[model samples]
Target: MRNQLPSSLHNGMMNYLSDLEWKQVLDSLQQGLCCCGANKYADWLHTPWIHVDFLRENSHTVLRYMRVDGRALPPVLPSSCCNPFSPTPCLHDPLQQQRSLSVWRDTPQTAIDTVFDKGCLDLILQPMVELLTAIPIVNGCCIALQLISGILLRYIYTSARNSVLVGDPGGKAYGWIFGRGDCRFALGSSLLDIDKKRAAKQKPSGNSGQESKEIGPRRHE
Candidate 1:
């Protein structure tokens, strides 16, 4: 459960992992990837992946590759881009796509990216080069861009849901990494404004016995 995360994680991370969440994270990570050969390993588990590293252009990006080896694969990038580290991450991207892992496994699996897919970038080289030249105009912009990009990806694919915790064990106040969460980022500015207004209104010299009237919901008849 989400509320139980702190104590449960504190108790131990693997300890409280539920069947659904476990299956989801594992499914998401190894979704498009399958193993073959003597020793089996999860597919694309390694990051700074070849397509990300070797692709010359967007079109040539490994995500666009038709096959990993001789076998076809799925377009399994996160739907929105946000730090997956962010719990309750928000933001959305329309580009995110989902793929059935079962389909890819029926065919053989492929792991050789640098060796086989090297020439793919040539197709988009010119425009990509032109775009790279313009990068100097933006400095350290990639960090913010990736953060937003990752957040935008959140909407594209189905992710494992955090457990719905009613309360923390023994009723202690639960710890949360809420500072980086979407709810904070989205409403923090407005909340700060409300805090300031409340502080000002509590002053001894402030207006008294004033009540605000409630407005009916827009949809209410």
Candidate 2:
């Protein structure tokens, strides 16, 4: 993705004036990212937008383009690349833009003072790298959370069973505690097992009660 930005941006810049949507997208990207051309602001010189034929159609005619230090000046940069805080008047005046371009060629190190010199590729890749770095951390946190939850549920289920076995006051309360709507929803079949255990305990007592009633009726006879 980082290596492909130059060619993609070159194509986008070349087609910028031809398509209004592309023009807007390129403009917004440059302005929002605070970046210039593909690899550097100088890269814009190679795009079709800088050619005389294209410029002539847009009323930016140049009878004879200027040169500085025996080097032809790159045409004015897109307004998007111009630094709003810079004292340079390169963006609004064609001559000043050419002058700044010449200055840049003479001293590449000072380019950012006049226009955004950093490549869009580096700025775009920084955030992507940060997000990828965090993915493992986020995944580890989720796995730890699941482990803690499983341990907690196992502890609660065991404690509830022990309370019922020791005949805690209101032993049926153990059933009610796990049988509530939210608990059943979360524990599902675990609560069903508790219900089955309670039912089994009650059955023997019911049978004993029936046997005693029969014996009493026989003695009366």
The models' CA-based lDDT, in order, is 0.32, 0.65
Q: Compared with the true structure, what per-residue lDDT tens digits does model 2 show for residues 1-221?
A: 76676677788887776778878987888889988887777677655464444444333434345233222334457778877778754342244456554554576445556678776777878899999999999999999999888877866776666566556634543433334344346545454566577779867765788888877755434
- Among these predictions, the greatest lDDT belongs to 2
Model 2, stretches more than 4 Å misplaced?
Answer: 3-6, 55-75, 91-112, 164-221
TM-score of each: 0.14, 0.58
lDDT by residue (1-221, candidate 1, tens digit) is 33453233223212212344633443342222221110122222221122333233344333455354522233332221123333432222112312323323452232121011212123224466667787865645877897777765553221211111322233322222332234546634342354356557666553332322234335556
Q: Summing lDDT over every window of 10 consecutive residues in candidate 1, give the lowest-scoring window.
A: 35-44
Clashes of 1: 14
Clashing pairs in 2: none
Candidate with the greatest TM-score versus the true structure: 2
